[model samples]
Target chain A: MTAWLLPFLVPFIVMNAILGIVTYVTLLERKFAARMQSRIGPYRVGPHGLLQPIADAIKLMMKEDVVPTAADRPIYNLAPIVFVLPCMFIFATIPFAPGLGVADLNIGILFFLAVSAMEIVGLFMAGWGSNNKYAMLSAMRAVNQVISYDLPFIFSALTPVLLAGSLKLSDIAAAQAGLWFIFYPVIGQLAFIAFIVSTVASENRAPFDILEAESELVAGFRVEYSGMKFALIQLGEYAHVIGASFLGALLFLGAWAGPGPEWLGPVWFLITAMLIFLLVTWVRWSFVRIRVDQILALSWKALLPSTLLLLIATAIVVVWRGVPGV
Target chain B: MTIAAPRHVELDYTGSERLTMNMGPQHPSAHGVFRAILQLEGETVVGVDAVIGYLHRCHEKLAETLTYAQYPSIASKTDYVAAMTSEFAYVRAAEMIGKIEVPKRAQYLRVIAAELQRVASHLLWLGTWCLDMGGALGGGATIFLYCIREREMILDLFESLVGARLLYGFYQVGGVRYDLPAGWVDTCRQTVDVIDTRIDEYQRMLEDNPFFQVRTQGVGVISRELAQEVGIAGPLLRGSGVAFDIRRGEPYSSYEDFEFRVPVETSGDCFGRYKVRMAEFRESLTIVRQALDRLPDGPISSRPGLKSVAQTRIPKGEAYARVEGARGEVGCYLIADGSAKPYRMKWRGASFSNLAILPHIIPGHKVADVVAIMGSVDPVFGEVDR
Candidate 1:
């Protein structure tokens, strides 16, 4: 009975912790983006806007859930839940520190990548069920964009898997104990760059964020959603972004391997993850969004072929050097 | 029934369904209260039906009711983004028909106000144009905030000069109502100098940026012939290789006293328009500095201060006055019947003419390019609707 309850308790705790972190991550992004834009952002709530997210959460919960009359009832109602589940589920496989995560599966990278891509299903459901043209158009663009970028994202993630000779994310993190993958001469740098570019595109950030372009599509697939549903969709997006940052930290930046005491490993991992998140956020705030055609052309003509080539080169190097752990 | 008689059927699979999307009057990037009903084939715009008059306040009819003394203030509402120039056009038309001799000092002061208004208006155009293209949450907001920072300084200068920030009724029938206050020139000089450096910073941020280039370059091509045929004015006209500027072609308000260059671009694309406005920023600044250095000391008004609504009356005649407003050539056509109020007043709003080119050039472009082209056109609906 204790063993069964423990299994459930850990996941419940992890989910709550992630929810808290995701809310704060939004505050962090707002403050950071505000700094870049030369203004103070969200300083009226708690001291320095620390409790702004909590206030926002309460406000969203209290607001009435508005449903469009023409909406496909079941799909519109369930889309946010479905969209948010996969985003949070990706975090289950990410090893925040060695033996510190909810579940460190053997097929960690693959699980993370596949689960992250599943958000598109919920995204499309929301777009199609909203019965709005902007939502429908944005949903179509999301399907095209997410499917195209996923390949390059997978190819780049596979580079670390190839270097470590392990499918486990813990093994990948451990292999970078000697030197972080980002500092590995040429191949690692090239693969890391590809990973970041694909991450930005897959995350629907600018200059690749043409789907929910505020100037054109308004809020895009989530335009019709209000109250808790809008909050859920926003949570899923930030959770996905945070999940990618964690994966990037583990894959390239030697997560949990910084200089400190053994117990401080998780702190180092959090700091590293935050740094990666900031890097992506910086890119998002620095460029205008490209057109949908241009975004697709970039993914196919530039990111796909180059990441494939880099993956092949990594495979060749791994075979020659007999893989690090083996 | 179809299976019983399977005749050879011709199916047109090449033609896709056209989506009719309404953008504006409530859009985030509509710039103002203007709407475009776009017929879209996939993402490409096949046709656009623009709708205006959401902001119309019957300024022409108001001109018929209000005297010349009161109309200049209302004229500022037409092109509220450049209130000084809008008021300039109306008062210049009154003075033209009335044959009122404006003092040299007043004319120079008008030049200073008009040039400063140009800088402020162009700064606003740059900010909103980037905000429309780049988005409110992205790098476009960065540029937008920075541009607004500089524009605020210019507004502060206007606030000091006219005691109003946005819509200033500084011009009267005969001359400007206010003279330069003590040490205002020093403050004006300092503000323009700071804005000059700030413009360089904006150029560094956006000019040569690949994202900006991809969005603007060759996106909205207004051919030289098309621009002339459509009767577009100001930067839209200059951008398309037309060297017709009201300031140079027909100088008014002692514009001939100051020397300046009008920038022209032959490309006639969005980027060309962007370049024309940026160059105009520097040229306007130069004019402000020159006018400040040579500001003569004399009375600000040729006529006595207004004591009644019908103090300034025009003889029965008609005259057209055009000023190089920040948007384009803001012209006022007035016909007075020996009364304090005009019998008929027609406003030749530059944005109104500039927007006419939209339907001519908008077809065959994507939905995204629509905003880019509209941003480049920079239509102030206050003028367009009026």
Candidate 2:
């Protein structure tokens, strides 16, 4: 590691930062809820509950790692890892700033799509392997909701790629150097709206959170998990949300392209990511959850068609103009 | 009672893949220790069996062992959320059997206490119901917190009067145990005003919310004929356009002196019931204001000559007293055989009847609608299983 933050150490630094941010995201949610509900949030452990996440991690460690006797032990042991890896892995190809990331893979978006899809498998395993009826029901819902939302999510995300004429995240950001994609006329704005909706749905945030509705299935897929295993699942969930927010930032908001000095490029990226995360938190707290049928109906009926039309229009615009980025 | 199973929706898909999920004996949104076996065809609820009685306290039987004058404390436990109504019913039954004349001031005070109790119970119902709807007013827990904050102001007022916050056995057979204290009426008006403002805030938050409308409107609709056949009362009945309220029709206590309109809706759905309860909050406040304004200056208790509760003699026969409780009708039946203790007692808890209609309503809707419908029904387990 050098003074400039070495290339080899970038993965280590980013991974640690992502994990740290994941911990604080939970704190952010708690504080956000407290402020909305008119109560003082965590304030005992640290100054304004800054160290609450560390305390929570330690408390989870001290707790007994309970495995249900009837559970599929091997899969139960592996589920958290399977779920968490893809979430962290997606950060690898996410260019935080110009040349200030782990990898500049040409197929960064495709890699993100493939890796994120692996999360549902891990989620299903967490549900199925638990050998509980509620868990199974939740897993079935997760499969249905995730798969249905994925189409709209991809179609919406691909609009920027169509405009950029490249799969690389850095190139996409570079394409938006002149102007952020959100300001790219009516077409970009439409895709941005669709992209945000699909993002919430795909990430299984309420009101699309039929999988872990808590009131219905009692923590849903992770109904049987405990101790560090339970902690891992929660970590994976927040990380996945943050990862999705990062992707949203890059695709629509022009990641790291803020009014700042060159040295503060990655800092701008972090700020943008956090702002997007705050937006997600706002939505998660604001709306009631929709029924599973209604969620599917929304994706199929409204989001899918609108995003598809936007995608086609973006493609035509790219071909007609022969855009500079293309 | 074996109610007929509800008709399932005619889905085009074959029912090859089915799932059964047990909701709770300890679930948060169940209200209290309620279990429901939900039969599902992939999130579509095909059938439901509501299992209850986990909070059973043998309340009616326990009343037989206690002295006639001492039963009000026990009655408070039956519907702990709105303890004043249960206490009032028990004392009113005793007063009816003994031919006791309540003081003019005591009757007005009873009206005030009972109306306030209705407001408190309805506030609690609104909060928990929003919690069950999973983020209607705000998040699942946000509206609950806001409502609880408002409820705290009411509880504080009650605590100052009765020296107990939740289960206040503040009524005697003849009159109330305590009178309104100095500056209490003004404080009550102020609290009611704050509550009125908050009720408007909740309406602004939930009534016009598109998400709330989508989840609640036309969902869990109980037809007028079905609601009448099942004999629902209170807001559930009013929501179905039955237009029957015990307070309005029967005019118990000093209700005849206060004029307020009964809120009725024709939708007979969760949203309709929500609107009815919201209207009830305002009406309850109106009744409280009227009772306070017309409050007479007299002795708090008619039987102030009596030294202690145990010394009070009862020359009684069978008597029944029913009140318009928050849920519906809360009736207390006393069968006194010319003695200090009752031979038998029967409590007709409204929650039992309200909860009975669950199996009839849940089959055609999705599983999530169970939470909405159950919340709209507003069953208290303490009342249901007493």
Candidate 3:
């Protein structure tokens, strides 16, 4: 029985752990938003809204599933699955502790970026398949906004690689043990800043959340969505945000590199990821969304150029002070 | 108000298809049941067609059926946000027709109430308008909730006096119905002070946010000429550099006794409007403080006699009384036929005119700016549809 269950054990454990964290992250966002707005968030479900996510999950599950009659049934059915699975797959490459992840791919950084980008296809499928004008408009916006920021996001991620001389996340994290790439030099700080900005834009968060802007598009691509399908899409979004946050911690903040016993490595990693998530929430609650054109211009005109300069500078620095790993 | 919308001109399209997006009879930032058919060429609003009268209650017709003294109740309901200003306008018009002399202390009380109402209305606008702009402008609902929380204090002050909170038809033909409750002035003073301090916190949070600036600055610009042509009143007009405040320009309700600036801005944009309203809050606090300070000691109301609301005979005459409401000028025109009821009544609300500039300015801006600009105009649907 031990031999038979061994192969699925790590995947089962990590999947459940991620799902549990993502469920509570939504609660965290709501509570944080409520505090920012000067109101009690969700206090009725459990002590400090602890059981609110569970209640929400059940409510969503029980709700009658709805699909727009005009929608492409197959793609409409498939979109959330497409959106959610790839987001979950991103965790496969993320090394939580010394040996505490689902799988340790050699090309983890590349795989993470590639898998994360797959989220757009699902977003587009949902947008197009829904047969809604607002959804179509949202799809157009998500395409423009997400694709534009992808350049800077990828370019900025290369900065840590430049400093570490490795593409593997664990190797990259181990390299950050001495000093996280965020503090390496002038270019390192700028890259970190760029990466954070890109992450916010990439995840379709506020100050860049023109897609689901309630006042404008009125729920955007998720306009026609209801019940469990809606929940899945939301899950996919929060999952992506937290997943990217974890990747960010691993790349820049020295994953699990805090003090205490080596066995407490996973706890340290969780704390850092959570801190990053809190920072992201702080930004989301504090800023208003810019226009679609403004978002695109900011990425292409501002962030892309700065990140490219940082990349070139990092390359120059890497050669000037030749490290043996490359 | 009959808005003369520009003729819809089909743009010479090079290739792309034009999409007409229906944004609310139920949309979040519509204020009320206002629908705008937006013709968009990639988010730029080429043309906008407004659908109105969604919340029509036939207030003018309803006023005709009500008695002269009882009409203040209807007036209060018309401009729901700043009910005191509307109530004051109707009461003043009746007082003028009947030649009812208001007591000195009662006049001061009216001034104080009107100013407090303005503060309440403006606070609500500040919150909802910031909410309309979403998080990019004023950090979204933080400002909104804070504004509401403070506005509730002003409501509490009203509730203590009038026995009702929002729609208090507290004014009478001769003067105000109730005198100041014991220590009410001090409570009011403290409330305004709290609100004044809270306004500074909003300024720090939103007024200094660079992203907020980008979203608002130079976005929904209504030129001075266009504003005058549209006859937009209050902040919407004043934001375009027009100095036509009924309070300062043509003083009424002993407005000349107390001093306050009619805050104006030249840009005539969303940011300009926002700045004007922010400045107006401080100005309102000044007016409230001044009125309370100079509140003369006298008969809290007129001597119980001929000028009683229900029994008072309205003479055969026509009188129009206008006051600078929180939105703008709220004018009440009453023509009494020597009967208990008015012959014909016309309530001219500022929001009706303010809503007209929407189509003119909306053509060049994005769909999102529609919410921001509409919010900046601050049209209370009750006032507009009435």
TM-score of chain A of each: 0.98, 0.96, 0.97
Q: Which residue pairs show backbone clashes in model 3?
A: A287-B135, A288-B135, A288-B136, A289-B136
Residue lDDT tens for model 1, B109-202 = 9999999999989999998898888888788888888889888988998888889999899999889988888889999999999999988988
Q: How do the candidates rank by DockQ, highest first?
A: 1, 3, 2
Separate DockQ for every predicted complex: 0.76, 0.49, 0.55
For model 3, residues A3-106, the per-residue Cα lDDT tens digits are 88866998999899999999999888888878887888999998988999999999999999988999998988899899998899999989999777877887
Q: What is the TM-score of each candidate against the true structure?
A: 0.97, 0.96, 0.96
- lDDT string, candidate 2, A222-285, tens digits: 9899899899888888888998888888987888887768878777777787788888777777
Local error of candidate 2 at residue B331 (angstroms): 0.5
Q: Which window of 10 residues has the lowest lDDT sum in candidate 1 chain B?
A: B1-10
State in Å the error of residue B338, model 3.
1.4
Query: How many angstroms is residue A9 displaced in model 3 relative to the true structure, after the best TM-score fit?
Result: 2.0
lDDT of 2 by residue, B1-386 (tens): 44445666656667676677788888867888889988888778877888988999988889888886788878999889999999988888888888889989999999899989999999899888878877432365677888999999999999999989998988888999888778899999999999999999889888777778888999988888888878788899999988999988998887888999999999989999999999999999998988888888998877855566566666758889999999999898988877778778899898988887888888878877888898999988898888
Give the Å error, residue B377, model 1: 0.4
Interface RMSD of 3: 3.0
- Give the clash total for candidate 3: 4
Q: lDDT at B279 for candidate 2?
A: 95
How far in Å is the alpha carbon of A129 misplaced in model 2?
Answer: 0.5
